[model samples]
Target: MNISENELKMMVLKACRGIGLPVAQAQEVAAAMAASPWALKQLLTQLAKPILTASFDFSIGLDIKNAHILRDFWACADAAYLASPRVCIRGVSSCDVTEALARYRGVSVVAQGEDLLVMVDERPMLKPARCEVAPDEWQQLETYAALTYVPETDASRLVGAGAGLTDND
Candidate 1:
C-alpha cells in the first residue's frame, strides 16, 4: 500500500505504542525515522527481530503534542534522562507543547502510560512562565484530558470522586 510521509511516521508511532512506549517516545522515534534514512533502516531491522513481551521501563518521559515542543523539550530534558531514569515530572496537558515549552522553563516532564506529567520547579527561573489561558480554552483542555483519561480497574471512582464538580468546577 502507498503511504505519505506523515502516514509512515504514524505507522512507526503505532508500532512504538504497541511496545508500550509512551506517545512522546513513539513520536520521537517516528520523527527520527522521518529525518534520517539510516535511522529508518536501523529501526526497521530492530522491528524485524523475534517477538518478545517487555514492559516499558524507561525512567524519564515527555508528554508533548507538537514538533516545536518536542524539539524544545528534547533540548532541555534529554541530558537529564540520559544521565538517569529517576527524574519525575508533575505537569498538565495542552495541545500545544511548543507554546508550553516556550512559555515554561525550569519544569520537568514525565510520562505515565499515555499521559504526560508536566512538573514545575518550586521556583521557576522566570517568575511568571506559566501560560495564561482564557476561561473557555482552559475548559476545553480540561474536558479533553477528562475524556481521554482512563480510570484504573481497581479505582473506585473518577479523579474527583463524586466531589460534585462541573465543567467550571
Candidate 2:
C-alpha cells in the first residue's frame, strides 16, 4: 500500500520501539527509513534478527566491529558524523540500507569487501512524499507495531475507553 512519508516514519518508529529499541534509536531508524523508504524491507529483516551491540573506538577513526544494522548502524552513523570523519564498520550485511542511512544523515558510505566505510559528507537527501510498501511487509510491520498497544478489555472500557453510564453530552 502507498503511505505518506510521515506515516511510514511513525509506523517504523512504533515497530522499532515495539521490538525493544530505545526511543532515540527508534527515531533514528524511523528517519532513515523515511528518507529512503526502499530500506523498509531491510529494517524488517534486521528487526527479526537478534540485536548485536558493537563497541566504537574513535581513537584514530571510528572502528565498529560486528555491528548489526538495526541496532548499531544509526549509532555508528551519529558518532561518525559528530566525532570522526571516517568510520570502519564490519560484520553487517545491509550495505544498501547503510548507504541510504548515510545519505539521510548527510554522510557517505561505501562497501568494500565485507566492511562499510562511512565518511561525513555535506550532501542533502531527497525524500519522496509517498512510499509504496508491499502488503506482506506492511502486515509484518503492523504486527511488530501492535506490540506497543494496550489490549482492549472490559476493565479498560469501564475505566475510560468508551461511553460511560452517564452518556448525556
Candidate 3:
C-alpha cells in the first residue's frame, strides 16, 4: 500500500514494537519535518537519524518519511550499516557517542528497553543506533527512544537480568 510519511513511521514503529529490535530501544523514529516528501527532503539530512535499536541481532533500516535519495540510497544505507554494526557504541566510543548525541540536534535519546535508542532525524527512519545501557540510559538517544515507541513484551523486565533475569529476550 502507498503509505504516507507519517504512516510509514507508524508502520516501522509498529514493527519495532511488535517484533522487537536486537538492541534495547524505543519505537519512536524521527518524524517528517512537514507532511510532504519535498519538505522532509529539504529539511532533514541524508543520515538524519542514526537509531541504535536493541531488538535485532544484526540491524534494520527504513526510509525517511518523504526524503527520497535520487541514487541507490538503499545501497548507501546498506554500506553505512555494513561499515559499522555498532557505530554509536563500537566505533564512536560510548563516551564520545553519548557526548555527541547530547550535542546533536534532532537527535533524540530515549530509554525504551535496556539500551539507548538513536534514530536520525528528518530522514532515514531505519538504521537506528542502539547502545549498551541498564543502570544508566543514553541521555540523548534514550530520551528520544523513550519518546518514540514502546514494544509489547516483557523484555523491559527481562533484559540484563543475567542470573537474576531469564532469557526471554
Candidate 4:
C-alpha cells in the first residue's frame, strides 16, 4: 500500500488521540511516525492487531457483554491464540470452567483471540496479566487474556515492582 507521509502522520495522531493518550504520548507517537515512517507503520499495524485476538480475565466479571468488546478481545489474541495453556490462580473465585484445571502454575490461561494478550519468551502465558490501566482505552479492563507472553516484550517488562507471580502449588 502507498502510504503518504501526511496520511500516516494523521492516522497516528488520530489513533493516539482517540485512545485518550496524554498530549505528550500522542506527540511522541506522532514524532516517531514523522521521524521514521517505515518503523511507525509497522508499529501502527502491530497496535491494530489487538482487535484480532485477546484473552479475558473473569476476575472483573463484566456485567454486560458487548459484541465490540468480543471483537477487540480476539484482536488482542491475534487469531493464532487458543487459550491453550493455563496457570492456576488462588484467591480467585470459581467460575464455569473446570476446577482441577487450576494448577497454580506459571501462566493460568490461554486463548486464541482477545485484546490485551500477554506472553513471555514468545510462549503462551498461562497467567493473567493485570494493569492499573489498559494500554488502549477501547477496552475497559484492568486485566488481559491472550495465547502467550514474552518476558522480553516491551509491555511485559513494564510490570511494576514485585508484580511477578509464582506458582502457589
TM-score of each: 0.30, 0.86, 0.22, 0.26
Instruction: Assess candidate 4 and give its lDDT.
Output: 0.33
Collision count of model 2: 0
Q: Which of 2 and 4 is ahead in TM-score?
A: 2
Top TM-score prediction, candidate number:
2
lDDT over C-alpha atoms for residue 10 of model 2? 93
User: Whole-model Cα lDDT per candidate?
Assistant: 0.42, 0.79, 0.31, 0.33
Identify the leading candidate in terms of lDDT.
Answer: 2
TM-score between candidate 1 and the true structure: 0.30
Q: What does candidate 1's lDDT look like per residue over 1-169, in tens digits?
A: 2334565565556665554456786576555444332233334434333433322334454323322233234433554434443432223233333223423344455566544544444433323212223344333324433443456663555553666445663
- TM-score ranking, high to low: 2, 1, 4, 3
**Higher-lDDT candidate among 2 and 3?**
2
lDDT of 4 by residue, 1-169 (tens): 3545554445555565554444454444544444444343234333443332224444433211222221222222232233433222222233212111211111123332331222222423233222222134213111111112224666656663455467476
lDDT of 4 at 104: 16
Lowest-sum lDDT 10-residue window in model 4: 140-149
Model 3 lDDT per residue over 1-169, tens place = 2334554444333333333332222122222221222222222232233443322234543322221221122222343344432312122212222323222223333333333334333432322232222222123223333444556468765673456644575
